[model samples]
Every structure is written in structure tokens, then in C-alpha cells.
Target: MLYWFFTNPVSLSRWADKHAEGRKLFFKCLYLFTAFLGIAVAASGAVESALAWMPRSWVRYDEDGESEWIASSIAHVAGFIVAFFVTLKGAELATRIRRLEEESN
Candidate 1:
């Protein structure tokens, strides 16, 4: 896993090279990657901000007599879920890139 982690840039470079060298739909794919990354960052940042603010007691709590802020908690988890999908999208992109790299080799 660590090895794979370290080698990601090489794969990314090759993928970018393929795109730069006249592959069609390059901008389309790049736009999707940018959008996904933007969404992932926004979602994760919102979750982090919410969790950080929770300690200040500014979050709303459910009226069921528990101190747990149920709605905010759910939102945090949903934010992470959205971020996780973006990560999965990245993995899928890497796999497709690797396949294309292999095919070209």
C-alpha cells in the first residue's frame, strides 16, 4: 500500500501526458476531476468545521433530552460519505489510467 501511495505521481504524470498528447475529451475529464476534488474538499472542510464548532456548544441538539446534536451529527457523517465517494471516483480514475498506461505499453 505504501509503495502504491508513493508511485501515484508517476501514474498521474503518465496519464496527464497521454491527455496532453492529443487524446480527445481531455478537458471534459479534467473538468470532472476538478469538480470532484472541489466537492470533496468542500464536504470534508464543512464536516471538520462543524465538528470543531461542536465543542463550543453552538450546535443544535435534539429535544429528546439528550445532549447529542443529532442533526449535525448526521450531516457530518453525510459529508464524509460525499467525500468518500469522491475518493472512490479517484480510485476508479487511477485504475482507468493504469489500464490505459498498460495498453499503450
Candidate 2:
């Protein structure tokens, strides 16, 4: 399996350099995608935080919020896990882009 999440900055730099040019549309699209993922990560985190603080009664489906809590909690955790990798990816891509820019100088 390609453990892209485990790749080092050097590998990321190499990948960026291999992408035809330093500032191609691919890079632009990647940057934009990471930016959006950042927003989603933030939103997911906020939702988790809010849910944590809110009263259990807010869900209002069952007498107890157990089911809703479990579902939302699972979703929140999943969101965080995904966010962790994507955040790393974004940072890696940004570092690679910077490396490419430096190399072109």
C-alpha cells in the first residue's frame, strides 16, 4: 500500500518537482483542495466541540441520547482521523511547493 501519509518532506518535494512544472494547474487544484479540507476539518472539530458541550437532551430522538451520541461521536472521531491525515497532506504539499519554488530560483 502507498503510505502517502507517512512520506517525508523530501519525498513530497520530489513528487512536486515531478509534476511537470512548479506552478501548474495541478498544484493550484491541490492547494485549493487542501484549503477546502482545512475548512471542513475546522467545521467538523467545531461540531464535535459543540456537541460535547451541549446537553444530551438536544438530540431529542430518544429518551436518552445514547444512539445519537454514539453516531455523532463516531462521525466526529472519523472526521478527526481524516482531518489529521489531510492536514498532514496539506502541510506536505505546501512544503513541496515551497521547495519547488526554491529550486527554481
Candidate 3:
């Protein structure tokens, strides 16, 4: 697998064609995970922020407003994951299209 990544451009396409379907599925799963985690983290942040704004006298709580950092970190990681998968999948699609065009020609 590492070799596949290190190969030249022509070799890369050959390698990709051999594992096209598997790679596609892998990237799709990665993309989905990123999306899911991002949403979850953002939701948690929103909830935490809401809680922080709530009247402390009515309901005593121990959570600090530091959850914003957690949310921001998650957002950054999720964004990277999302971007990686999007580019990977787009390359896969472009390769598939190019192959099909070549075959038709």
C-alpha cells in the first residue's frame, strides 16, 4: 500500500485501477465519519455554550466554557478529514471517468 502511494503518476493510476472499488469505499467511510464527528462535536459545543449561559443559581454546574476549544479542535480535524476524503474520492471519480473515456476511444 505504501508502495502504491510512492509510485510514479502512471504507476499510481495502475495501482488505483487495481484497488479502485476498495479505495472508493474506504474514502466514503472516512468522509462519513468526518461528517458525523464534526456534527456531533459542533452540537456538543452548542449545548455546552447554552449551558454556560444558563442561570447558575438555579442549576449548579461544573462545566467550564473551555469546551469551545474542544469544539474548535474537532472542527479543524474534521475539516482536514473531510477535505482529504473529498479530494481522494474526487481523484477516484476522475480516474474512473478517464479510464472509461480511454476505453471508449
Candidate 4:
């Protein structure tokens, strides 16, 4: 999935030399946001799966037993937080691009 996201032709930027600074910045921000979001979502899914497969007995506080679920849950939550920020940044950049286009017309 990560490979597909990075290599997809549809998301590639192909601005002409006359492209405005605002447009370039918008595309840069949009791409970075998408990449980060994709990574976060993938990481979250992996952590969730690991957490789910962990045995419940491991979480019962046995001596020498580690609670893998706790660590996995933390990772999942962190990914979610980063994903939220990336999404917000992406929306803001997109809106800026739209406004600039409207004004240029």
C-alpha cells in the first residue's frame, strides 16, 4: 500500500513553469500530508492487529510476562493523533489553493 501511494501517477505533481508559488506550496503540502496519513493509517492497522492477536493471559500480570497489548495500543493511539493533524493540515492547504485560484480568475 505504501508503495502504491508513493508511485501512483495520479498524485504526481506536474506543474508548469508558470505555476504560482501558492499552487506549488499547496501541492507540496498536500503530498506530504497524504504520505504521512497513509503511513499512520497503515501503522495503526498493524498495531491493532498485533494487539488483537496477543494472548489475554499475557496481560494478566504474570511474572516475566509482558503486556504487548499495552504497547500496541499506545502506538495505535499515537498514529491516530498524527493522522488527525495531517488531515487538518491537508484540508487547510487545499482550501488555500482553492482561494488562490478563485482570486487569480
The CA lDDT of each predicted structure is 0.60, 0.59, 0.53, 0.60
Model 1 worst lDDT window (10 residues) = 1-10
lDDT of 2 by residue, 1-105 (tens): 134413343444455567657565565456546655765677677767766766665552556634465446655676767776776676767667877878999
lDDT of 1 at 28: 39
Residue-wise lDDT of candidate 4 within 8-101, one digit each (tens)?
3123333411454557666556666677778698878876776676665544343676544565666679788767786667656645775676
* Alpha-carbon lDDT of model 2: 0.59
Regions of candidate 3 where Cα sits further than 4 Å from its true position: 1-68
Q: TM-score for every candidate vs. truth?
A: 0.42, 0.40, 0.37, 0.43
What TM-score would you give candidate 1 relative to the actual structure?
0.42
Q: Per-residue lDDT tens digits of candidate 1, residues 10-102?
A: 444455566566753464355446656666668866776666645546555557766765446656667768966875676577668868878
lDDT of 3 by residue, 26-89 (tens): 5544444554555556665655564554443443233673324343444456556655665566
TM-score of 4: 0.43
- CA error at residue 53 for candidate 2, angstroms: 24
Better by lDDT, candidate 4 or 3: 4
Error of 1 at 29 (Å): 25
